[model samples]
Target: MSKHAGVVLPNKFDYGYHAEFQRQCSMCIDDATIEGIVFDFSRVEYLDSAALGMMLMWQRRAAAANKKMMIKGAKGATAQILAMANMQRIFEYI
Candidate 1:
């Protein structure tokens, strides 16, 4: 994850990435100049429940920091999964 570009999630956005994601978002909260985060799902083939939880965590953290969060490239099953989780209402899909 680049400090200025935000995180471009891995192809498998799963539990394995949780710890790192948390760390990155934590940094975002601390950096006053960081304006927002874009969670890129373009390469993600499978997004499991744990991934959803991670996103939710980031959402809360971003909100606390007064930053916006955007989800991009959610296709096919990935789109359905986010929809099922009702993440659309809380997050904007780009």
Candidate 2:
């Protein structure tokens, strides 16, 4: 089975929401046999350093598990943020 899962980042992804984000990611990763993760950022208006860090962490975890990690629906400011962080190269954006 392909372990493909997706998470829609809340409109506001900030420090306070870190734990929830982590929990969601972890749950998806742990529950799936395959390691494919797709983080849907279509709804996110702004992302801070913490969000970036969380993304990186999830990416690494997925990589370690030999899973494909991707980012989808990133546009506007969110797209710029990922681009600035050089995460565009690491994630597949759709």
lDDT of 2 by residue, 24-55 (tens): 87887787575677888889998899988888
In candidate 2, which residue pairs clash? none
Highest TM-score, which number? 2
Model 1, 16-43: lDDT tens per residue?
A: 9988888887877788877777777888
Q: In order, what is each prediction's RMSD in angstroms?
A: 3.2, 1.5
Error of 1 at 20 (Å): 1.7
User: Alpha carbon lDDT of residue 7, candidate 1?
Assistant: 75
Q: What Cα-based lDDT does every candidate model obtain?
A: 0.82, 0.83
At residue 77, candidate 2 shows an lDDT of 91
Report the poorest 10 consecutive residues by lDDT, candidate 2: 28-37
Per-residue error at 41 for model 1, in Å? Answer: 0.4
User: Could you tell me the lDDT of residue 60 within candidate 2?
Assistant: 88
lDDT, residue 63, model 1: 92
Q: Give Cα distance to truth, residue 94, candidate 1, Å.
A: 2.0
Query: Against the hidden reference, what TM-scores do the models get?
Result: 0.87, 0.89
TM-score, prediction 1: 0.87
